[model samples]
Target: MNTTKRPIVTGIDGSGEALDAVRWAGRAARLRDVPLEIVHALDFPALLAGGVVPPPEEMKDTLRAHGQRYLRAAQEIAEAQGTTAVTTRLDPDRAAQALIEASRTAALVVVGSGGRGRLTGLLAGSVASAVGAHAACDVVVVRGDSWDDPEVADRPVVAGIDGSEPSARILAAAVAEARARKTRLVVVHASADEPRPETEPHLDPQAATEAGEQLLGELTGEHEAGGITVERVVVRGHPRRELIERSATAQLVVLGDRGRGGFPGLLLGSTGQALLHNAACPVYLVRTVS
Candidate 1:
C-alpha cells in the first residue's frame, strides 16, 4: 500500500543469503533515511524448468498466492527496521531479467548468491551475478553463511580506486557512506604484479604507480568538504586479492565491475571474480553505465 519510493531493492527467496541482504539493505536504508523495496521475481520458466512448479489453477487458489508469501516476509523485514517498504512481484521468464529491470531505478539493488537452484561450486548465483554485472545502480551480493553472525556491524567502508571513472564513483559513494556513518573511509588502489617475461606489452610499473597517485588526488579533491577524514593506500598486487584481503577487516568493500577504458557490462574481471568468491565479508559492486 505504501507507494513511496525507497533507495534500495533486494531480491528475496527465503534463503539465508537473501535474508542477510535484507538486513544489510535495512541498515543502508536507515543510514540514508530512505525506504527499502524488497522484490521477489517469480520466474515461471525457471520454476517450471527446475521442476518446482505448482499445481494447475484448478488446484490452486491463485497464482499470486505464492508471490504474496515472499512479499509478506519482505514487509515484515521493513517493519522490523521501523521504515517504510514496498514489495513488488515480477513475472519474468528469467529471475535475473526481472532483478535487472527493477534495479534500473533503484539507488541500490541486493541479491543473494548460491540458492536452492544454484549449481555446485558457483560462487555467485547466476541471477545475482547478472544483476550485479548489468544493473544501472549499485548491486550487493550477500554471502549465505555470514548471515548468522551476531556481531555484524558497520565497520570502515573501503573502496578500490585506480584512476578510472568507475573507480571515482566508487570512491565518492564510499566517502558519502563514511560521512553518514561516522566511520573511517579507506581508499585502496591495488595493482597486479607486472606481467611475466613471457607476456608482451605489459603495463609499465612506474606509470601505474603515478597514475594511482593522480587518481587518489582527483577523488580526494572532489570530496574535500571539511570534517570527514579519508585514508588512502596504494598496494602492489592483484586487485581482487588485495581487496578481499583488506575486506577481512572491513564491514563493506566497494568495487567497480568495469575499469577505466573497459566496457560497462563486464561486472568484474578475473581478479574481481576471485575476490567475490573468497571475501570474508559482504562485497558490493557499483555498476557503471554510459
Candidate 2:
C-alpha cells in the first residue's frame, strides 16, 4: 500500500503515557490524512505467569473487557485530534511484538516514553524500547517529558545525521515535519571524533568545517529553497550528548535506523538507544524505502 494511506498505529497498554501516544498518533493521522489505529495487546502470557492452575474463563473476559475499555479511551483521544478515520484493535500478543506486527503495514508506529504495566499490564517503557528498535516503518516514541511544555511547542525539529548518504533522508524528513509544524529544521552533525577519511593522515579542521557546511548546504537547498527555514550545525562532540541537549528544546528529533555519525552506531548504535530513552521530545526513527 502507498505509505500515505497507511494508518498511523499506536499501542496502548492503559497507561497515561500510552494515552499521550494516542494523542500524538491521532495528530499525525490527521496531518497525514490517514486513519488512526489504537491497539491494545491482551498479554495473557504476562498475566498467566506465576500462576499454577489456569485462571477461570471469567478472568479472560475481564482482561478482554479491560482491553476494550482502554481502546475506547484511546479512540476518544485520537478523535479529539480531528481525525475521523479512527480504528481500534485488541490483539492477543505481547505488547512490543504486537506493535511491531502492526508496524509492518503502518505508516508510523507511536508509543509512549514510559509507563508501568497497569490495567492492561503490558508495559510500555520497555515496549517502547523494543518497538523503537524493530519497527518496520517510521517509529515515534512520544515522550511526555517535554512535548507538553509550552516552551518547546515552537522549537525546531532537530535531526541527527551521521554525514552518510542516508543522512540526507533524515534531513528531508525533518524538514517536512518542521514545515508541517511551521517551525525550522536544525540539521545537527556532531561526533566524538571528527569524521575524517582514514586515507587522509592529517585532516584540516577548517577544511572539515567548510566541507561539512557545503554538504549540509547542498543537502538542504531543496528544502530551504522551498521556504522551510533551516539551521545546519556541525560539532566536534558526542552526537548523543549534543542531540540529547537539543532534544530538550526540540519539537521532535529525527534519526536514521542505520544512523551513525562517527560513533560506532547511532540509533542502531549507542546514540540510537541513548536518544530513544533520553530524548526529551519524540524520537523519530526513519527506516523505509523513501
Candidate 3:
C-alpha cells in the first residue's frame, strides 16, 4: 500500500555499520538529487511467541520507541551530510522483507554488510544477503575498509565487464554513478582463456586487445559526450580474482547480478558473490528485471 515515489532507501539498525550505510546512502541521495528514506523494521517474529496475536500494549510501545530512536539517529546522520530531503519509516516487518518492499519504489536500496543479528559470524548477514539477491532495483552492500575512508571518494568507479547484456546494463549504471561523483570510470574485462576458437580464433592477442578497446568504446560511446573520463582495461586472468584486486583501490565496484557464465537458475552469480564478500569497496549489484 506504500505508493511513495522512487527514492534512495536505506536500511538501518542503529549499529555502527548500519549508520555507515546510512551515511553512504545519504551522500548517494545527495549526488542523485533525490530524497533519502531511512527505514528501521521491527522484528515481528521476534516480538511474538507463537501465534499472530499482537503483543501487549506496553511491549508494543517499547518496540515503537526503539524503532523511533533508530529512525531519528539515521535522519540526523543524513541531514548532517546535507541531504535535506530525508524521510523516516518504521515498518513492522522483518528487515529483509521491509527492504524488499521498499525496493519496489526505490531507485536504490542500500544496507550494511552485517548488522544486529544472531548470525554475526557471517561476512554478510541474512538481511543483507536477502535484499541483495531479491531487491527489485539496484542494491548496494556497504562493506570493506574503503567504504568508511573519506579518501576513497577520490578514486574511480570500477565496472566489471563480460560482454554480456547484463554486463552492459551494469556498465550504464556505473557510468551514471561515476558521472554523478565527478570521477572517472574504469572499465575492466578479464578472461582466463584466449578468444574462443569457435568464435574468433583468427584474431591474435594484439587484435583481441583491439577488439576489447572497440567493445569498450561501443558500450560507452553515448556517455562519452557527457565528458566523463573512461579508462579501458583488458586483463588475462580469472575474472573474479582480477575484479577483487581492482576493487581494492576503487571507490565503488559495479557488476551485473548474473553474467553469461552464471548458472541457469541462479539469482546471484558466483563472481558477484565473490566480489560482494571480498571487495574493498561498496559493491553495487545491478540486476535486470525480467
Model 1, 157-275: lDDT tens per residue? 78887666566677777887778767778888875542445544565777777777777877787676655767878777877778778877777777777655354345555545655
Residue 23 error, candidate 2, Å: 1.1
Write one digit per residue (lDDT tens) for candidate 3, span 100-157.
Answer: 9999889999999888873745777778788888999999998886566768778999
Question: Candidate 3 has which clashing residue pairs, if any?
Answer: none
How much lDDT does candidate 1 score?
0.70
lDDT: the better of candidates 1 and 2: 2
Question: Which candidate tops TM-score?
Answer: 3
Using lDDT as the measure, the top candidate is 3
Enumerate residue pairs that collide in model 1.
191-237, 257-267
Taking all chains together, each candidate's TM-score versus the true structure is 0.82, 0.87, 0.90
TM-score for candidate 3, residues paired by index: 0.90
- lDDT by residue (tens digit), candidate 2, 1-290: 23358898998888888888998888878777888889999876666646556567888899899999999988998899888898899987889899999999998899887765533543237888788778888889897465866677689999887777677777878877887778888998774444556775664667667777777878888777777788999876778899999988888999876654334433355676778767788889887333
Off by over 4 Å in 3: 1-5, 51-54, 193-210
Question: By TM-score, how accurate is candidate 2?
Answer: 0.87
Better of 1 and 3 by lDDT: 3
